[model samples]
Target chain A: MDVILLQLLNGLDKGSAYALIALGLTLIFGTLGVVNFAHGALFMLGAFCAVTVQRLLSISFETIDPDKVDFLGNPAKVKTPYVESWFGPEMGGAIVDWSVPIAILFAIPIMIAIGFIMERGLIKHFYKRPHADQILVTFGLAIVIQEVIKQFYGANPIPTPAPDAFKGSFDFGVLLGFDPNAVIYPYWRLVYFGFAAIVIAAVFAFLQFTTFGMVVRAGMADRETVGLLGINIDKRFTIMFGIAAAVAGLAGVMYAPINSPNYHMGMDFLVLSFVVVVVGGMGSLPGAVLAGFMLGILESFSSMNVIKSIVPGIDQIIIYLVAIIILLVRPRGLMGRKGVMED
Target chain B: MLGLEKKDTSLLIIVAILTMFAPFILNPFPEGSALAQFNAGYPDLMQRFVIFGIFAIGFNILFGLTGYLSFGHAAFLGIGSYSAVWMFKLLGYNIIPGIVLSVITSGLFALLIGYISLRRSGIYFSILTLAFAQMSFALAYSVLTPLTNGETGLQVYNSDPQYFHSENMPNIPHLFGAKMQGTYSLEMGPWSFDFNTGYYLCAIIMLGMFYLAIRIFRSPFGLMLKAIKTNQTRMNYTGLNPRPYTLAAFVISGMYAGLAGGLMASMDPLAGAERMQWTASGEVVLMTILGGAGTLIGPVLGAGFIKYFENIFSKINDTVLHQWFAFLPDGMENFVITIIHPFVGKGWHLTLGLLFMAVVIFLPGGLVEGGQRITAALRRRAGRSGRSGDDASSTDTTPAE
Candidate 1:
């Protein structure tokens, strides 16, 4: 029972990222009909925002202090860093320490600007082109984005840790009347899960409750009809594109501790997210979140000792196997509407 | 438009003959001259020309005729390469048996992949094929280390269990005049030529494949594939099954990829998992598009252009740039080098991306369309001076596509 709860906790954090990414992907696919192969790159860019901000605040220049002391017949020089002088000690250290949370403000405008430029520059021309053309162009865009990142950051993964405040794990098992260490869960992971749930809820609430969300949803249902009604549906879709980019970006920012930021991290998310979207049924937002978490849990459970003993490589491909089965069994997916990707 | 007649056909034949003798037509560069770097008449680049030509041609057959954009075709090519390398390791280094084995291996693998993937169509089909290729890549990277040699890649080394022993087997195979960079140089003052047998062998094989592709394009099956591409649902409604035709196209293209792969290993026996990767697969698609998808000759031209650019771009350094800008002041020369540095070598990809965007945006029909537009513009200026052999471009990149 304790093991089950611990694994469940583990699954929720991973599932949060998948749900967030998949939700953003479905939003773009549903509204724009572009598939947006570069969404994963957007996600990658989100994490890099954190890396950039961290580098900005934490990067320091070493300087020799004017005062010197001699000890044991050797001249000793005091060492200092320029950041202390620039940001004034405590505040600078705090800014550097809290780069992850600070990146949220930095990531929003950066990601929105990126999303707007991408839609305006290349994706606008491909609106009437074949799905293959959309795929080809977007794929090329993904590669270019990744290569640019690689050029800037190099290929290796850059580790980013959660702030020091959330370092320790909570003794949830003991609180639940079980052994102390049996169901140990990290506070940061719990925070991540909570954050993901809040974001997911907020997005759903915004879409389901607000006027803007209603218009976007209506536009998704019928862009032509909405445009005929003189609503500036294209502009709305563009905003939705920005929103989707922010969602993916935030997911990436939050997921930095889960997996270190690398240029090729986007490629890894790409196909898997596609599978998640397909399994949930294309254009279904809720379905994407549900399927994302479901696959994530399945993957986690498959990696367990009991399951691995039964199937040697189940963990490696459980999600894909589930996807193939779901797709084969129900071509429209669990919550897919008719005529979406049916053509 | 050449009246679609015999006189135009003769002109095309003449052009083909000239292209075949391009080595003789090109001005020879002096040995160790700066211009020597630009001379792609060398055996190494020639081998790539034939191999990638075959790869692009095979891809064209699928994407061009069927309009089924497969982004994972390199899996077959990689399989072919692996099989050819195995043949060389197990059998002798003779080209014939290795080529035969490669074709068979690639064919079988393609058939299997095609059979499974062809169950879906459009985006689903693309995704399925990509997934399968990625799976192959992952398997090769991890579990299939014995066969693929894992990250290190497979290569020829030491003694094999040769049935005829080492004494009888000549290390490499040869055919016609050209050899695979086997012989160094036959110099004549400033000019020199090295013959490669493997390249000649590949060239002959390519010629044969080209002939086969032309025949296939003219066949009933080819017409059916074109129909499938235009209206898959309509074809189904007409009681014509599109599966067999699509599967056949897939397999045939797969075999072509395999043949290219076999040639690669033959040139230098090394097979790596990277060959089967998604990016590698995507490169073939790029080659096909850049050349003009459906056209027979376009893929070869595209392949040559890409490979040549890749070679030239990778070779450019700051020093080379400075030499070119020697007339400038030292500061200006350094500035020029800095400006051009990002576009050279691996950075050549930046140039490729820009070119790709330009091509896709302006000329959706690819290079063929660009050529036709150029011809049309010229014809307008010339005031119907000569017969327009430009019908080839229109036939290749039909606006209806």
Candidate 2:
């Protein structure tokens, strides 16, 4: 029972990421009627945005401190961050420690601008083209974006630490009847889960409550009718694209501390995320979220030692395996609508 | 000749001649010259040109004729490579058996995947293939380590028990006693040409395959595949089963990929999980598109172009850039080098992606279309100066596509 609970938590955290990415994918597919292969690259860029803020916060200068002797018997050159100099040490230290969260504020406008440029410049031209063309162009764009990131950041993964407060594990075992450490989980992962839930909720609320989102929703169902109604539906769809980009970006920003930021990290998640979107049912936001969590939990369970002991390397391929079975059994996916790529 | 139309037969003959004399034609730049670096006349690169040509030609059969965009065809290629390597390990150092086994294994794998994946159409089919390929790649990289050798790649070992081999036989991959890597370079004046055994063998197979592709393209099955591409719903209404036709195309393409993969191992004698990755599959798609998907000779041209750029353009560095731009003013040369630096060397992929985007956007029919347009324009200009301006105008309005 404890093992089950622990795996569920693990699944939720991973599922949170999958849900976030799939939500963005579904939004774009729903609105634009095009598949954006560069969505993962946007996630990668968001993580890099966090790295950028961390670097910016920790910009330091070398100062010779006469009080400290060097190994070579000279005055030691001590490096102090500019943040520490501007603010007092404690405040600046805290600011540097919490750069990942602060990156949310930094990543928003940049991601929005990126989203705007991508939509207006490239994707706009491809709106009426075949889906294969859209896929090919976006795939090319993804490669270009990843290569640019690689050129700047190098090929290696850069470690971005979480805040000091969220560093340790949370003992869920003690809260339950189980012994301590039995259901141990990372606190940041919990934070991530809560954060994902909030984002998903906020997106839903905005779509349900806001006038703009309602118009967008109407456009999604019937673009020609919305256009006939004299709403500038194209602009709204463009904004929705930005929102989707922002969602994917935020997912990447929060995910930085879980996995180190790397140029190819987005591509690693890309195929799996597409599976999530497909399994969730194309263009279905709630379906994407539900399927994300389901797949994630199943993946976590498949990776358990006992399960792996039986199948040897089931963990490496469980997600894909599940996807194949699901696709074969339920051709339209869990929540797919009629005539959504059916032909 | 060869059951092809007169025009296609002539095109086949031209291609055969080109491949036969590629060593001489590709080595036009004299050795030790500044432009020599651009030349791709060596056995390794030439082998790649033909092998990848075969792969792309096969891909075009399915994607071009039937409009089935498979993003996981490299799985078949990877399977073929592993099978060929295993054949070399278990049997003697004969490439014939390895090549045959590779085709059969990949054909079987393709049949299974196509049967399931073809149940769905359009994007769903693409995603299904992608998932299956990724699953295969992950398995090959991890659980199938005994078969695939994990990250180190599958290669021949010193202790391999070759049951059919004698004590004095050459251990490297060979055709009877002839080594696949055997090369004879002939120097004529400033121009040197290489005649490699593996390259000629690969070239002959490619010619055969290209001829086969031409025959397939002109056959009744090919027209049916095209009809399916035009409208599967209509085809269904007309009582034609699109499933079997598509499956056959898929399996045939997979076998071609397997043949290419087998040839790859025969030449190099190693197989890695990376060959099965979706990126490799994407490369074949790019080749097919860049050359012209449905047209004969397009895949070959596309494959050759990409392989040439990948091999030759990537070898260039900032130093070479500087040398190339030395005639410019100092600051201008530096600026030019800086601008060109990122799109070459390790940045070749950036250039490739940009070029691919440009092709998809502007030249949807790929290089074949582009070539046709240019020639048509040129012909129109010539006719305008002469007497047949009206005829030229009529031909210009209707694109060959």
List DockQ for all candidates: 0.41, 0.82
- Name the top lDDT candidate: 2
Q: Distance from true position, residue A37, model 2, in Å? A: 0.9
Error at A320, model 1, angstroms: 3.4
lDDT of 2 at A239: 92
**Candidate 2 docking: what grade?**
high
RMSD (CA, Å), candidate 2 to true, equals 1.9
lDDT string, candidate 2, B1-401, tens digits: 86777777888889999999999988889999999998999999999999999999999888988888899999999999999999999998889999999999999999999999998877777888999899899899999999999999999997998788877778788899888999999999888999999999999999999999888888899888889888889999998889999999999999999999999999999999999998899999999888888887888999999999999889999888988999999999998888889899999998998888899889988888898889778888988898575542322112123
Candidate 1, residues A6-109, lDDT tens digits: the string is 87888888788888889998998899898777888999999999898888777676554446646654456544335666778877677777889889899989
Top candidate by DockQ: 2
Q: Write the per-residue lDDT of candidate 1 for residues B1-401, one digit (tens) a residue.
A: 22323543443455356445545433267768987767766777777887898899898888888988886798888899889888878876766677888889889988988887787777777877777787777777766788888899988777666443356446554222233547555678887765556666677777667667766765788788889888999999999888999999999999999999999988888899899988888888877777777765667767878888888788887778877999999899888888777778667776776666666666666777778778878777666676643433344334324
Task: State the lDDT at A313 in candidate 1.
Answer: 55
